[model samples]
Target chain A: MWKAEIKVLLKKSVLDPQGQAVEKALSSLGYGNVQDVRIGKYLEVSFAAGSHKEAEDQVREMSERLLTNPVIEDYTFELVEV
Target chain B: MKFGVVVFPGSNCDLDAYHLVKDVLGEPVDYIWHQEENVSGFDCLILPGGFSYGDYLRCGAIARFSPVMKSVVAFARSGGLVIGICNGFQVLQEAGLLPGALYRNLSLQFRCYFTYLKVENRQTPFTSGLEVGRLLKIPIAHGEGNYYADADTLRRMEANGQIVFRYATADGEVTDTANPNGSLTNIAGVCNEMKNVLGMMPHPERAGEAALGSQDGRLIFESILKNWEGAR
Candidate 1:
């Protein structure tokens, strides 16, 4: 079995509106050195695959098609034996 | 012209769209369930607002994979008119029918209000009879309505008049404060490069009649009707 940990974030050039709001809240609470903040999503997916390379390829396909929106977001994944 | 409104699993506004066409506009309309693959016998297609696929992965992302979408995409490619409103707009972006994507509101709030819109391009069938820079009072309800496109794509759209509407002051100025959702260039609506497809974040069906508080929205439907009539 293989487990995939996926992370999705808004493109660097795209505005992270919710992240900005959280950053502002942090600063007002005296966390002045917060610098910047960006929000992202993490997903844990497990499945049976022939090999780790096959699992990685499958995860890549999933991310490119459904897990992320190419227009506004980007995604990356890491696979491990479970 | 007959209309077909696609009803996906989570569509809440399909009935509103049907009412707008059948009861309000006095036109023939039909409901196309999400699983169906055929979209014949309809001149125009409407994708109404609501959370499809429970908006699980992303708004419109999963819905784009619906069986009916294949036919809708084909219809659009054949130059048939398609109107996507609110969540429908998000679906079109996912379906690649229209340019750009919508993001969460800058204020991180679901906004529901009667906002002002400026007619950006009046030459297209959707706004042919409308005056340029006309101010339209329309209601918008959504949490993710901030429109964004790459600078190059936006420039091309500008040159081709793909932009159809922009949030504006009642006096017709496109200013920072007039923007409700922080959309790039105050964009509220846009058409495909061919001008056959339009995706907008406003709820035009909700504002279709005076009893609903404004009749401005009816013009969009009427425009589509006339376009169909004029073609033949």
Candidate 2:
């Protein structure tokens, strides 16, 4: 079995109000040195694959088609055998 | 002309759309279930506002994959009239029927109130009854109503007159203070290149009757009816 770990985030050009709000909260909490904060989603999916290449391909496809919205978001993933 | 209001599992405004068309406008209307694929026989389809799929994993992300959306897409491609309101707008964007995406409000709050909209494009079938620069009082309710499109896409949409509505002052001044959701350029609504498919954050159905504190929204239904009649 292989587990695909994915992180989805709004594109650099897109505004992340949630992230900005969190950043403000952190600043108020005395984390003034933190210059930036970006909020994103993290997911872990475990599935059976014949080979690492097949798992990687499936993960990439899934991320593109369903896991992330390309219009406003970008995603990165890593696959690990479990 | 017949109207079909699609009913997704979490659609709370389906009845509002149906009531506006059937009761107020005195037109034939029906409810189309999300699992159903057939969308023929309806002159127009309305995707009403609500928390579809409990707004999980993005507002309209999961709902865009509903079986009925496939037929909706085909219908739209054939030049059928389709309107998506609020959550429906998000679904349309997710399904790639419309351009751009809605993000969380700049204030990060669920804004629910009456707002003024300046009609930017009167050529769309949905806004033909109104004159250019008309000011409409409509209610918007959503946390993610902020519209955003890349600079290039925004330029093209402007050139194509696809921008249908914009948040504005009651006097018809487009201003940032009037923007309820902090949408780019204060955009309140937009349509596809063909102008057959429209997606808007405001709830016209909720403002269709005088009892609702505004009858300005009735003009939208009237425009649709008038356009349909003229075409037939």
Candidate 3:
């Protein structure tokens, strides 16, 4: 089985309102030294594949097609065989 | 002219769109199921607002893969009119039929209220009835309606006149305070490069009747009808 872990975050040009709210909360808790915060999504998918290369290709396709909106977001993934 | 409204699994505004076309506009309309692959015999198509696919993964992400979308894309490419409202706009962005994406509202709140929109481009079939800088009172109800596009894309859209509407004050001024979602440049609506596909965050259907507060929303539909008739 191959497992793919994906992380998606809004591109730098796009505003992360949810992250801003969280940052405000942290500041209220005396974490004023923190520079910034950006919110993102983490997803894990496991499936049977022929090889690590095959798994990597599948994960990339999935991320580009549905896992992320390339217009406002970017994604990174890690593939491992189990 | 005949109209078809696509009904995704979670579409809640399908009926509203149907009513606006059939009862209000006195035209023929039908509901097109998302699972169906064929979309013919219709002059225009509408994708209404809703939490399609339960907004899983991301808003409009999962629903964009619906079978009917393939046909919708082909229809748009063939120069057919397609209007996406609110959630429909998100779906259009996800499907790559429209430029840019609707990001989470800057206020981190689901805003449901009346907002004034300034018509930026009056030549589109969807806005032909309005004059430049015309103000229309429309209501927006969504959590992710803040429109975002890269600087280069925005510049191109500006040059192409693809931008159609912007949040504005009652006096028809585009300003930050009038922007309900902190959208870039107060953008509320845009059209594809061909200008046949329009995607907007505001719900014109909700404001189509005077009893609902304002009938300015009808102008958009009227514009489409008038322009379509002119083209024919």
Candidate 4:
């Protein structure tokens, strides 16, 4: 079995309203040094795969096909043997 | 003309679409279930607004994989007319039937208000009866109606005339002050490259009658009917 940790984030060019709101809340709490904040999703999955190479490719495809939207979001994955 | 309004599990606006078509528009319409796969024989298909699949994972993410959406995507690929409203618009974007994705409102609030929109494309069957640049008052009800896309895709969509509607002032000026949801470029609606599919953030059904506050949305239905009539 292989385990994968995936992170999905809105593209840098796209505005992150939720993140900005959180940033404001943090700033109001006295953390004024914070310049910016961007929010994203993180997911972990365990699946059966033959090899590390196969798992990496499969997870990448899954991220592109369903886990992240190419138009507005980007995704990255790290795979490990379980 | 006949219409099919797909009713996903949490679709609150299916009935609105059905009532608008059958009672108000005086046309034949059916309520299609989310699990159903066939979408044939309908002049147009509507994916009504609501939280499909409980909005799990992401807005329109899980619902994009629903059984009916497979057929909806197939239908749109074959040049069938499909209109997605609000949550439906998110589904269309997630299903790859349309361009761009919706983001949480800039204010981080679920906004329910009347917003003015400018008709950007009169060539589409969905807007053929309406004049380009005409301002339409429509109600938007959603937390994630702000639209976004990469710069390249945005440029291409603009050049291709895929941008169909933009949030505008009452007097019809597209500006940030008029953007209730903070969508990139103030886009309220967009069509696919083929112009057969449209995904809009506003609820045209809700605003289709004067008693509801505005009758500007009626023109979209009228435009659809006019197109069908002309084609037949």
Candidate 5:
């Protein structure tokens, strides 16, 4: 068994409308100190595999195929021995 | 036809979709909770509209991580038919099963009303009952329906003919009034490269009855049935 930590984030250039709306609301509430805000998702996935390399490969494929949208999001993963 | 509708905690439209599928379409359907890990017996799976997980983090953020989504993703990858409507569309985007994200309405308000959609690609099983360029009257209720995608992705989608629907007027005129949300290229719906997975923001189940003023939404379900019948 191996543990994988996956971080999924929208591409830097993509407009995050939800974050923008919150920013606007904060400004309206008189909090002008907020500079930049971007929202993202995180997942900790666990699976049983023989080796770290195979586990990492599976995590990468999962991220690309279903965990993250390549067109708008970028993801990175780290595998830990269990 | 046997169908399954995934039901998350905050899913308000699951029953509505259940009735539409079982009562309106005269098909057998079941509601599967979001925590389930299997979805093997159904021919079709639907993620209906509503504020899943109370729209807690983002529109569909929390719901995307539901255990049921794993099965839904597997089903879609295997060429099974899946439809995500309204909030369901947002879930699909967050789950990375579909391209693009549904952003806040360009006007920055929650919009709830009837809108028109132009069928762009009828080759898909979802739209095969409609002619290309035909208009559909459907209701849309969402705050994040403004679709956004990069230029390259949009070009690829267009080139591959994956765009299934565009906002249009009732008379089939492509106009801005019908575009409730300022979606990129006025895209209302799209399919995966294989055209088996569909994500759209309109509530087709809400328009299946004539008492709702138009029964046009039935055609979408009918198209799915037609495709399944032909495949069998």
Candidate 6:
């Protein structure tokens, strides 16, 4: 069994309305020091595979195929041995 | 026809879609959980719209990681018919099965109401029941429905006839106000290179019944069935 941790984020130039809303709310709460805020997601996936290379390949394929939107988001993954 | 509708934890449109297919269209359908891994047997797969994963992180961000997406992607890549409406469109974009990204409505508000769309290309299997330039009235409810793609990408889409729908008014006039989300070029929907995978922000399922004030959306499902039946 192998595990992969994936982190996904919107591209830098893309506007994040939810993040901006949270930032505004924070400012309203007097947390004025927060300059910039961006939001993203973290996912951990586990699958059974024969080797680290196979797991890595699967993880990469999954990221491109579904885990991340290459047009507006970027994703990276880390493998864990089980 | 055997159809599969993917259901995420926070998806509210699954039942709406299931009923739209099973009851309204009188077709057999199944509700596939997001964590399920296999989707090979279904004739069509639907990514119904809703606030998946409570719209956390990004609109369709978390839901994109669901295990069902793997099967969905594989199904689409194999030229299977897949439709993503509204939030489903966001998930398709977030899942990299379609081009462009959905930003918040230009006004930065959650918009919910009926809107008009122009059928841009009827050549695809999804829109075969409608003629090009026909107007369709559909409801759209979302905050992140504003579609954006780079200039070159937009040009390519136009050149390749990948653009399937554009926001329009009841009078068939294409205007910015008619475009609820301020999408680039007023695009409301597009398909992949194969034209089998469709992603559109308008909720066709919501407008399929006369009780909903319009049955124009039924043509889309009819189109799919007709095209598939002819192909087989």
Task: Please name the candidate that would achieve the greatest lDDT relative to the true structure.
Answer: 2
- Tell me the tens digit of each residue's lDDT in model 3 across B1-232: 9999999999999998899888889999999999999998999999999999999988999889999999999999999999999999999999999999998999989999999999999879999888999899999999999999999999999999999999999898899999999899999999999999999999999888989998988899999999988988
Give the better candidate number (2 or 4) by DockQ.
2
Which ranges of candidate 6 are over 4 A from the true structure?
Answer: A1-70, A73-82
RMSD of each: 1.2, 0.8, 0.8, 1.2, 5.2, 5.2
iRMS, candidate 6, in Å: value is 3.3
Between candidates 1 and 3, the lDDT winner: 3
Binned by DockQ into CAPRI classes (incorrect, acceptable, medium, high), candidate 1 is: high
For model 1 the local lDDT of residue A78 reads: 84
Q: Higher-TM-score candidate among 1 and 5?
A: 1
lDDT, residue B4, model 3: 98
Query: Residue-wise lDDT of candidate 2 within B9-82, one digit each (tens)?
Result: 99999999999999999999999999999998999999999999999988899999999999999999999999
Tens-digit lDDT track for model 5 on B1-232? 8999999998988998999999998999999999999999999999999999898746887898899999999999999999999999999888878888886687778889888889999989999878998888888888889898888889999998889999888788777776788888789999999899999998999999999977888899999999999999
TM-score, predicted candidate 3 vs. hidden true structure = 0.99
Candidates 3 and 5, the one with greater TM-score? 3
TM-score of each prediction = 0.97, 0.99, 0.99, 0.97, 0.79, 0.79
The deviation in Å at residue A50 for candidate 5 is 23
By DockQ, the best candidate is 3
What 10-residue stretch in candidate 6 chain B is worst by lDDT?
A: B56-65
Clashes of each: 0, 0, 0, 0, 0, 0
User: Interface RMSD for each candidate model?
Assistant: 0.7, 0.7, 0.5, 1.2, 4.0, 3.3
The TM-score of the first chain in every model comes to 0.95, 0.96, 0.95, 0.96, 0.81, 0.88
Candidate 6 lDDT over residue span B62-166, tens digit each: 888799998899999998899998889888888878888887787789899988999999989989889999999988888888898877888998988999999
Estimate every model's Cα lDDT from 0 to 1: 0.92, 0.95, 0.93, 0.92, 0.88, 0.88
Which scores higher on lDDT, 1 or 2?
A: 2
**Which residue pairs does candidate 3 place in steric collision?**
none
Structure candidate 6, residue pairs in collision: none
For B60-163, candidate 1 gives per-residue lDDT tens digits of 99999999999999999998889999999999999999998998998789999998889999868888868888888889999999999999999999999999
Tens-place lDDT per residue, model 3, A1-82, is 9889999999988889998899999999999987789999999999998988888999988899988989989999888778
Clashing pairs in 2: none
User: Candidate 3 A-chain TM?
Assistant: 0.95
